[model samples]
Target: MVSRRGTKSKTPGSKRTSANPPSRKQFNPSLHRFQERYEQKEFQAKPHGIPVRVLSFMGVTVLAMSMYSGYLYASYQREVSKAQSLDVPRDVSDRYNSTAPTFDAEVELSEKAMRLGKKRGDLIRLARGDVLEVSCGTGRNLEYYDLGERRGTDDQGHAAVIGCRSLTFVDLSPQMVDITREKFQAANPEFTHVAFRAQDAGAVTVEAPARVRDLAGAGKDASDHRAYYDTIVQTMGLCSMADPVGTLRHLGEITEPERGRILLLEHGRSHYDWLNRILDNLAPLHADKHGCWWNRDIGAIVEESGLEVVEVKRWHFGTTWRYVLRPKILCGEKK
Candidate 1:
C-alpha cells in the first residue's frame, strides 16, 4: 500500500528505515522496575560459604579431643613406667595408717567400688563360734557379725554379755588395729571376748592374740591351731596383702576342717577376655598404687590356696567374687 503524500508508505508492521530509529523507549518504568529487582536478587544471593562460627566450633572440638587423647596417652605411659619398676610398695602399713580414717570414704569414691553394696554385713553374718577375721580393717565387719545370744566367758570365766565365744580382729596397720579395737569395743561393749592384733596375717603364729588356746583349754594340742577358730572371714583384704597366696595358704592351714567355713568378699580379675586384658594392662598401676593385683584370678587363687570352694557368686564382669571356702580334707583326715 502507498501513502497519499509519499512514494510508498511503509506498512505499520514494516521495519524502520532510519539507521538509529528512536531506541525502544530507552526505558519502560514497569520493565525497568523488574530488571532492577532481578539485579538486586542476583547481588543478594551469595555463594554457599561456611559460617565462621561453625568452622571455629568444629576446629576447636577436634583440637580439644586430640589434646585430651594425647594427654591421657602421656599420663598412661608415665603411670605404666612407674608401675613396672616397683613391686607392690612396702609402705602398705604406713599407707593405711595415714589413710585409715578416710579409707571408707576413699572406697566410696566410686559407686562401682562398693562391689554391689555393703557386703561386709553378709561377711559377718557367716561367722559363728570362735571367729577370726584376717586383715580386719577398721572393724567394718564388727557391726555385722551375728554375735547371737550366747554370752562369752567373763573375767571370772562365766558367760556374761551374750555374743560369740571370741572374735579376733587382725591387721598389719597399727592404726587399723586401734580403729578396730575402738569399733569392736563400741559394738560389743558387754562382750570382752574381742582381741585386736596388729601383725601380718600370714605370720600370725602363737604370738598373735588369738582365742584358740583359750577356747581349746589345756587338754587341746597347742600345735593344732586349726581347731581353735570355727569360722574365718575375709573381705577385700586378700587383694592388698603383700603375699595373697601365702596368706591364703596360712588361712587354709588355720581354718578347721570338716565343719569350719571361710567366707570371702573380694574383687579381682574380670571374666570377660577384653576386660581382663584391660585389667592386665592396668595391673602394674593398680599394684603400685593400691598394693593389690587387680588382675589376679580370685577363683584360681582360692583353688591354688588348697581351699575347697563350695560356692562362688561372681558379678561385675567377674571382677567381684563372693566365695564360700572350706578346708580340703587332708589325706589322713579323709573318711
Candidate 2:
C-alpha cells in the first residue's frame, strides 16, 4: 500500500515488480522430456558400445583359432590319404632311379643310417654259398663277401691281404644295377664273382643250372618248381617295396627246403607307444619325401607273412631289427 502511493498506478491485473525479478515457474513438458531422453541414451550407449566392442574382439579371436585348426587338420588328412594310397612300383622305381648313382654315399653318410654301425659286417659274415642280396644298390655288401685272402703290398709297403668273394646283386632299377656293377668292379678288379640283375624281386623266378649250384657248393634243390639259394639277404630294402608281406612270402617260396634262411636288417616302428605315435603322425610325410615307410612293424610283417621267425633282435628303441627267418612250411609239412 505504501509503495503504491509513491509509484504510478498499474493497469488492471498488472503488478509492480522489484529491481531483481523472481524466476517464473513456467511449464515446458516437451523440453524436459527431450533432456531426460538424451541423458538416458548417453548412459545406455556408453555401456552398450563397450560390450559390443569386446564381443566383436572375442568373436574374431575365436574365428581365427578355428580357421587355423581347420587348416592343420586338412594338412594332416592330405598326408594320411597320400600314405594310404601309396603305389609301390611307381614310387619305389622313381625313388631308386632318382637316387641310384649316389644311394650308397647317402646311406653311409646319413646319421640315422650310420646307427647300424657294425651290423653290416655281421650280415656279411652270414653270407654262404649261393648267397643273394636283393635291392643291392651300389653293392655296399660286395666288399664283405667271404672270399679267401690274397697276400698283397699295401700303400705303405706293408704286407696286406685282401679277401673277396663272388655274389649276385639284384635291384629293380637298371641305373642302380649299373652303378652297383661299376662300384664293385672298381673296388675289385680281380674279383669277378659279382652278377648284377635289374629285375623285380617279387616277379623274378629263381633258376640256375644244377652244375652252377654244385659249383657254388650249395645243397640239392627241394622242389622242381622252386630253385634253392643258400642264403637270402635284405637290408633296409623291405620298407620301399609295395608289399613287404608279399615279398617275404615269395622269399619263402624260393628258399631251400632243408637249410635256407633269410637275414634282414631293417628300420621300423618304435616299440615305445609315444615314439610310435610320433612316427605314425609323420610316417606319411617321411614316406612321401624319402620313399620308405619308417614306421612299419617289422615283427608284425614277419608274422603276417607266415615266415617262421627263428630269431629277432631289436636295437635303437626297436626301430632297427635283425631277423633270422626260416622258410615257410606248408600246413601239411609241419612236423
Candidate 3:
C-alpha cells in the first residue's frame, strides 16, 4: 500500500499485501462446474447454404409425414382384410332433391376458385341443334350458353341458332329440375322451345323438341328438325348415376348417329397413384355429403360406354375430365 506521502509500505494489514493481491473476479459456481463437452451432434452441423432452423423444420416435417404414411398403410391393410357384406344401395338423386336450394351456394365458391366456369363453357359452347343436357342441376351452365344466334349448321347438318335449335334439361330431382326451370325461364323468357323434365335421365325416353326457329315459323314445321339429339351433354353427372356406363350408352343411342357429339365434363380419379389412394379413401364420405363418387375411374367408364372418343383432355392432376365423344356405330373411326 502507498501512504498518503506516496511511499510503499510493508505492513501486514496493508491493503496491497500479496495475501489479498489484486481483487480477482468473483468465482461463479456455474462457470466452475465440471463439464465434459468435448464434442456434440449439434457441433458437427455446419452451414451448407441452408439455415439450422430450416434444417430442423425439414427434419421434423419428414418424420411426421413418414409416420402418417405408415398409419395410412396400416389402415389400408385392415380395410383389405375386412369381409364384404350387402350394403344398402345409395341413390344420390334422392339426396340432390334436398340439396337443391342451396346447392349452388354450397359449391359455387370452390368452383369459382378452381375456374370451373371456363371448363363448363368449353363444353356448353360445343353444343348444337336439339341438345339434351342430362342431370342439369340448377341450370349452372345456362349463363354460359352464348345466346347470340349461331350462324353455322349443326353437326347433323341442321341449321342452328340461339346456341341450339332446341334445349332440353333433365334431372332425377323434381326440386332440382324446378330450380333449373326457374333459372332458365328468368334468363331466357323469349325462348319457349326449351323443355324441362324431372325424371331419371337413364330411364326417360326424351321427347324430341321443336326447333326454336320453328316456333316463330318462318314457314317451317315445328317438327321439321325433330329427331334424336344432335349433341348430348352431361357435366358432373356420371359419378352420381346408378348405371354410368348404361346411361352413357343410352345417350349414345339417342344421339344423331354419324355427326352427333357427347360433351362431358366430370371429376374422378387422379393420374398419380398417391393421389388416387387419397381420393379412394375420401370417396365414401364425399359421396355421402356431395352425392357423387369423386374417385370413380372415368376413363374406364367412358371406355365401357363404347362411345368413340372424338377428343379427351384432363386437368387438375387428371381428376377433372373433358371429353368429346361420338356414336361408335356410325362413327366407326375416330376423326
C-alpha lDDT score of every prediction, in listed order:
0.73, 0.73, 0.80
On residues 213-252, what C-alpha lDDT tens digit does candidate 1 reach at each position?
Answer: 3334434454544344677888888777766778888877
Q: Which residue ranges in model 1 land beyond 4 Å of their true spot?
A: 1-74, 85-94, 111-116, 149-163, 205-226
Q: Candidate 3, which segments miss by more than 4 Å at Cα?
A: 1-90, 148-150, 153-162, 208-226, 330-335
lDDT of 3 at 291: 85
Report the C-alpha lDDT of model 3 over 1-335, residue by residue, as the tens digit.
Answer: 68988987777866753666687899776655533242444456645788889999999999999999999889866653341221324556577878989999999998998899999987898887778899999889998765534676756887755367788899998998999999888888998778899888787665857332222243444555434787788999999988999999888877876568999999999899999987776566667667888888999999999989999999999999999999887433321
What TM-score would each prediction reach against the true structure?
Answer: 0.66, 0.62, 0.68
Give RMSD to native, each candidate.
Answer: 13.1, 18.0, 13.0
* Consecutive 10-residue window with the lowest summed lDDT within model 1: 206-215
Count backbone clashes in candidate 1.
1
Candidates ranked by TM-score? 3, 1, 2
On TM-score, the stronger of 1 and 3 is 3
lDDT of 2 by residue, 1-335 (tens): 33546975657789767999788999899999999999999897675545777899999999999999999989978876776675433244457788776666776767345556577777666666566778776676666676543666544787644343346678888998898788778877776555678988776556442112332333323332344666788888888888888988887776665567788998998889988987887776676666777888888899998888888888888898999888866755622
As a TM-score, model 2 comes out at: 0.62
